[model samples]
Target: MSKKETPLFPLRKGLHTRQAHVDLPPGTFEEEHARQGFYGRTTHLYRLHPVTDWTRIEGPLRPHCYDLNPLKPSAEEAIRLSMFGSTEAGFAPICLLHNSDVALHWVAPDTMDFFYRNADGDDVYYIHAGAGKLETTFGALTYATGDYLVIPRGTTYRFLPESGDQRYLLIESFSEVTIPDRNQLGPNAIFDPAMVDTPELEPYDATPREWAVHIKREHQITKVFYPFNPLDVVGWKGDLTVWRINVKDIRPIVSARYHLPPSAHSTFIANNFVICSFLPRPFEEEEGAMRVPFFHSNIDYDEVLFYSAGHFFSRDGIGAGMMTWHPQGIHHGPHPKAIPLSRTKDRTDEVAVMVDTARPLQATPAAELMENLNYWASWK
Candidate 1:
């Protein structure tokens, strides 16, 4: 991630230098990239107009905190949690876990035609279900089930789900979302660069009409009305851009002699948290080696896992869209039966996404509504 290694995502010519944005048509647009050498990496941007032609129409969103605090981990019985209510819609996503470094959300947008910009930090959207198109100023990215949409900060975009039902595990990183440095794996990226689906330049010219582009900055949502759609960039080129990758395209590293730690499956990393995808892989086949994860305490991180699909051999009764949290200082592991059951199996099809944060995470009120109160007793 240096000046020399930035050519891996060149969408066009002349965008490697500060003069990169000067080549665009002079009028009717503004250069809007991020200069984050102070923060992390710089992202160049070009927008139809200065994204500042906005009028704040509302107050900040409700504080994201919970009333009841739960901190128990599951050993055998699965602990379930939900974020979406029966009728939540639009840009309103349920905040499930939060701390100083990151905030995790469950978003199911029923009507998603409006634009949105996170003035806060980078966002990683894990699509648990549904298919749709994400139109952003950088370009258009087609997303489906198992796709993780990585959007940088300050990018204006809108999501259009083919159907009204869509489930997303959204992680708002209070810093840049970067690829994990797995130099030990090889000189290549953790996931192959060829597997990434970067958006191509597909500009849309909407007729003059009112559009609501919500801007979230400093924990507040300001509804800004614009004269036209803001995602009108005809071309963009830079190392900093939005991209998508499906879980199926990711090949997990496995060890038959020993159980691999969660870090072996690392996908993306930020300042204080790391996101990993647990895809289908072969189980440990060696004799006397533990097939299930051994009991251990999360001494330095808070772990959150969202079950995506298939049978997870380590836990029982877990379902799709369910989430489990194991905060710092808690010891958790497979059910008592999972170890013996895993010995009878040679492979697994479980697909899950994990977020481990260095800082302790606080649960939201919405997450408390679906907690399995008897989870702690299951180990008995």
Candidate 2:
């Protein structure tokens, strides 16, 4: 049998004819069919500047002291401001990724009352300091410093700060966020069900309040404010509601007799990547195990680590509120000094979140501006 001849332009020329018909309305044909040449085709959206150009978008908004000073009154006020306003709320400045989808919100002491639900994306709150009660449908979860709370998509909740005062690094993923996969640790090794502490549900009764919903339109760069309280749902069921889990409860599954790898402690998973916490804990093997991460290269995904508290031995310049992105390239590990120092200690006090993406992540101009651009190619 002979092969049939395929049309040169399958979608535009072969599929549809562009003949003018007298029956059509005078302006309808032009309005609808004017740009038919590019129909049914895939296009690549291109950027004019280099991907690492941090100044390509709005420059850095404002800079504030990232450190937490318990005596600072302005720090607490910033928390109150963010609770009432969006990222625009002028409390402490929020540093966002080049892509606006991900943002790090800094909230200070006595700064509670951040009640919000993600209408567009998911948000994960990493407790940087203080203790508080998270009121959710499932119940009330008491969280302290170094804890991670994930408010799933559309899950409504409120933050009730305790008397001690608090600070937090709000990580708004803007995409569905989940526990990092445990493939590296074999089956169900990391974040086992028993290790995660699901908070007890608390019941409360009060007059329902209203909330504001903002909608973004296509091609329009403004926010449309709709005055409607989403809490209208008198009741809810299923896991769609609010919940909290303590990062401490996620016990690390270490090798009994042998030295376990860093992947042994991962706890969550997402679509294309996983999130791991390099927490403070004792090593599983040998009388003394290096508490700090060793130098290594991530061939699988781009690794982005956010330092919350404690000293990061690997990197000298790193401190709380600092973010480091180690894309797939050269090796990144603790500073040469850290390896020898960590070996002496049986455990560590460090707390950090590591995000590994199997695919390359695109940064919005916002992220580039907040990033320490000098660190882009520093590993080399």
TM per prediction? 0.76, 0.60
lDDT leader: 1
Best by TM-score: 1
Error of 2 at 161 (Å): 3.1
Candidate 2 local lDDT, 71-189, one digit each (tens):
23243443433232243231233333323335444554343333444564565777867887776545567788877787776565556777775667666565787665455665455
Q: Cα RMSDs of all predictions?
A: 19.1, 16.8
Show where candidate 1 strays beyond 4 Å.
Answer: 1-89, 203-205
**Backbone clashes under 3 angstroms, per model:** 3, 17
The TM-score, computed over Cα atoms with residue i paired to residue i, of candidate 1 is 0.76
lDDT of each: 0.69, 0.50
